[model samples]
Target: MFKDRLRATRISKKYTAQQVADYLDTGLRNYQKYESGDARPTFEGLVSLADLLNVPTDFLLERDEYLDALGVSVDVSLECPPRRPKPRKSH
Candidate 1:
């Protein structure tokens, strides 16, 4: 599920696998394996990829059934408001 969505999102964004690999600071082979579902990315790696692609993590995860119910298309490249960090409590 993630593999298919990753490939589709990359293609939709007009990004080559090599380009994505470079962005993620990973080898071409490793990135290819990711797209092929032979390997999965770590949580940090997924966050990095999502940042590089300007997408929400959920978009790459392809778990947008709720969005679909609301008639929203799951296109990750769309520009969204910057995420605000949670407030930290003072000691």
Candidate 2:
């Protein structure tokens, strides 16, 4: 899914593979591996691709469905549940 989105976005944005590789500071072969599903970019590379393509990182990661399926809004703020102390053992 990620590979498909990446390729589609690149094509839609009129970016060549070589162009994307240059922007990513990687060799064309390595970039091709990303589209071929043989490799994945690091976290920073993923963010860089999103920024260069003017898309959200979540979009590239295909996380929109998770939000939609869970009825979660982008503005929803979730806090971690508080941890409670364990009960002491009886003497």
Q: Which lDDT tens digits does candidate 1 get at residues 1-91?
A: 8887787777777789899999889999899888778899999999988887777787788768866786766545533334345469999
Whole-model lDDT per candidate: 0.79, 0.79
Candidate 1 segments whose C-alpha is farther than 4 A from its true place? 66-73, 76-91
RMSD of each: 14.6, 16.4
Off by over 4 Å in 2: 66-91
Clashing pairs in 2: none
Candidate 2 lDDT, 12-64, residue by residue in tens: 77789899999999999899889778899999999999888877778778798
Give the C-alpha miss distance for residue 63 in model 1, angstroms.
1.2
Sequence-dependent TM-score of model 2: 0.72
Alpha carbon deviation, residue 28, candidate 2 (Å): 0.3
Report the lDDT of model 1 for residue 59.
77
Error of 1 at 24 (Å): 1.0
Q: Please give the range of 10 consecutive residues that has the lowest summed lDDT in model 2.
A: 75-84
